[model samples]
Target chain A: MARITREEVERIADLARLTLSAEEAQALTHDLDTMLEYVQALDGLDTQNVEPTAHPLPVATALRPDRARPSLAPEEAVGNAPEREGSAFTVPKVIEGVES
Target chain B: MAQRLGTLSELRAALDDGRTSASDVVAQALGRARELAPAFAATRGLRADRAAEEALQADQRRTARALRSVLDGIPLLLKDNLNHRGEPTTCASRILDGYVSPYDATAVERVKAAGGVVIGRTNMDEFAMGSSTENACDQPTRNPWDPTRVPGGSSGGSAAAVAAGIVPVALGSDTGGSVRQPASFCGVVGIKPTYGRVSRYGLVAFASSLDQVGVFSRTAADAAALLQVISGHDPLDSTSLDEPVPDYAAALDGDVAGLTIGLPREYFVEQGVDPDVLERVRDAVKELERAGAKTCEVSLPHTPYAVATYYLIAMAEASSNLARYDGVRYGHRATGAHDLQSMYSRTRSEGFGAEVKRRILLGTYVLSAGYYDAYYRKAQQARTLLRGDFEAAYRSCDLILTPTAPEVAFALGERSADPLQMYLSDIFTVSANLAGIPGISVPCGFARDLPVGLQLLGPALGESLLLRVADAYQRRTDWHTKTPPEAS
Candidate 1:
């Protein structure tokens, strides 16, 4: 039985960087457990020699010329940013004790 | 009832022969879109004025005998996930509530270059996460066949728009049956090209590996025309295939004589499939056989594990892809955050809908330490087995046929509360996506007064063959000719 505990759910949520309410966390425990149990059906399949296929089609990483080309203007690139200052995106400070 | 417009080819002929102006066609389609809004809820927004201006340009080009392909002056709707410069590219999510794209998607750019006027953006599931369109941040798109039922999603709005004749063709991104399932429900033709066949440059990522931009149209020929226009290699997308794209429209000779089609026994006997849907699909096979196509039974032993494998991989990728919406750059940002971490968590919590959050959480769980090998890795290996199944099956057959979905469109909110039930709706369509093959859903027949779809899948880079079989079936059946009463 693939049972996910409430603590485990909270830990996963933290790792995912999602803020969940107490109710959401509790409900997610049940949902996750249900889904996990269902997918466990795959556990019975014999895949001893099978290679993991990460991509559906076989594609080698494509390389392109390194020459610089015209790109989006800074103003246009950050046009959708919720907070911006002079073509730079403004965000909450990452380091504590840092001066703005 | 509003009178429906003709197919893309018919419209093109009208424009070329001076029977109707591009402005007239665009105006008429916009008028119908507005009138059908309450019943179908297909369009999230419209660009009627801008479309009219583009239509005038197209007419001017026609007058100068300089038409740009058959798509010149044709109006089409874009699934909202596709970026169009200066237009809102919300993937029907609150996170992207007011986000406007700064450039056009590669597909959108190609359409514009061909003189196709962008009419509007259609609604979809929040971040293309759900089977039904109910997850949209805006309103749910109703099936044109029955307003009380849902138009299957996350391309429901695009399917509904095409099914209702609001536009003859529309672009939709298919990740695990998003395009085909909705097209089946709405009684329109939808095609998902081989993975990497269509460039995903500006498409909002759902599950990057599984996502492929597809097309919806009233006929296979029309779908072919549109696919030909938007397909081909794009340097901007590293994953886009570098193979030469054939003339898909010309490949539609409506002849499938002596072609071998394999019917996977597992799909027909699956537990949850509606009997009527299976019967309709069987009848379609019989029709194809009578038209000189040969059919044989094949076994894809690992088919039963496709749903589980698809979800695990899709969610895992979605979790990683969606981490970009961290309230730092574009999209919705939360207020009252004291730290960067809080800003991200709170903003995502406030922006995402239920289904999206659930997938993200599940994805995180599978990829987390200790459980990674048990779930994520196992699913990946199983995906390889599933792909092997298709590869082996294709060794004897040119194409495979199955039902596009388990059943016809269901009522809104019917399966909304049960996530697993909703997930099962894509059972018949996801395998093609998993195997990276070309697949198309063509309206086959009606069941219980609703349309049913017959899906045809082909090998990788086999779009021409898939379209040929579907076009031939369409020529023999009148199901694609029937219009929903709401728009007739």
Candidate 2:
């Protein structure tokens, strides 16, 4: 296992969409390094030809009827939104250059 | 002493015989909860007025002799992770600070339909991530037995409430020993049903594959009553099993004669286990043997790898599941963000606690480029071998008995400083979640005056057998009957 560095911690935090302070990044680098070291015990075990068990039960994805019945009203759907315009949620511009 | 609020069956009989009104029962429970709240910090949100109205309706139904089920008129607390309509489902995380659920979790709906009163929501670790309630956004819940020590978590509040005799039962989500370990620490009965046995539709997902809503109660029979109410298939939860649901309470006859119970040597004689906890569990096995149940030693050779495998898999799933909590649609949003990207990053950084953020970062790292095959995939493959180990062991024994936790509850901040040490606390209980089996932790005896739980694990969809064995052991012991001094 490779040692986790502060730069690596910052990169992982970026991928996770979380912003870390310099102090937090330094601390997490140490924590993740230790955790990775602990989990490296799996490297000794030979899992050759073994399939991964994602879900315990062997169930296929359940599909529902295509027809729409009762569903949440638009306002109810966005009821907990921090900002909303009319019946839809207001975000900070997904397509920055384009105007609606 | 004030008359103890009895178990579900006793409360039901009281309502049926007109000895006590449901209104009075709810009032009594709310009062007791309020009295103990300052000391234990068990409850986060209490629906006192709504609970009173529900109790009135229950009392009217009792007069008309039209009861919904055994849970009718019983007051129970829900772990904060469960969504109840119009109530905040915080999962004890600031990210969900002011969000109110628009609909009930399937388990909550079933409990309400069965006439169980939703008295309040209990405290837990933030996003069910920690072994102690200290991770909660609210103040940590202390053990009812010893105020200086923690009531094991992320279901700490529910366990504390039940141990304090404020409620007969409560619902909790157990991703990895959240329910069972707390119950063990607090001297109560907690049941984590087979992964698909109970629907997880409205539960705030922690680790999708590992998370299962479970029950905490004073007795195995009460846990069974609550489990039966919540267990079944739900179309909303695709992973829910379509198997036939059993009357779990009816199956609890306390008969263990001629049954084979496997004592997993890995857990009992393990190096990290406290001698006192091991001794009490061994004594409980002997007592069960005297009651005609056979005991045999079994080995789950891959037991040591359970913690490592569980954290990797669970953190990966948590990272994916928690991606939905971006700032736009719901939950807490960050301020002064000029762009969309900054909005997400700042919102998450501000909203999540240290532990939740750590897991998310670690999870992202493991699933990122180059490390996926080495960490995530390997953990999953090892999980298969661990599951196989359980299957091989169960072939010879009806149920596996082990200590729920390696030791009794420690002081509140003892293990909080070290995350790896905190993670190891769930060592004995994580395997059942990994293997998707049902396990119950019942109070066996005391270790240094604090309670120790004896864990009984059964194969998939084997809740009835697990309950039967636990109920049998409970019938021969009075450990569950010993209430905390503060509660008494």
Please give each candidate's TM-score. 0.99, 0.98
State the lDDT of candidate 2 residue by residue for B101-210, as single tens digits.
98899999999999999999999999999888999976899999999999999999999999998889999999999999999999999999999899999999989999
Q: DockQ for each candidate?
A: 0.88, 0.85
lDDT of 2: 0.92
- Docking quality of model 1: it rates as high
**Global lDDT of each candidate:** 0.92, 0.92
Residue-by-residue lDDT tens digits, candidate 1, B1-488: 34577899999988878899998888888988899999888999999889999999999999899989889999899999999998999899889978999999999999999999999999899999888899998689999889999999999999999989999999999999999999999999999999999999999999998999999999999999999999999999999999999988788888899999999999887478889999999999999999999999998999889999999999999999999998888899999998899999999999998899999999998998898999999999999999999999999998999999989999999998789889999999888888999899999999999989989999999999999999999889899999888778
**B-chain TM-score, candidate 2:** 0.99
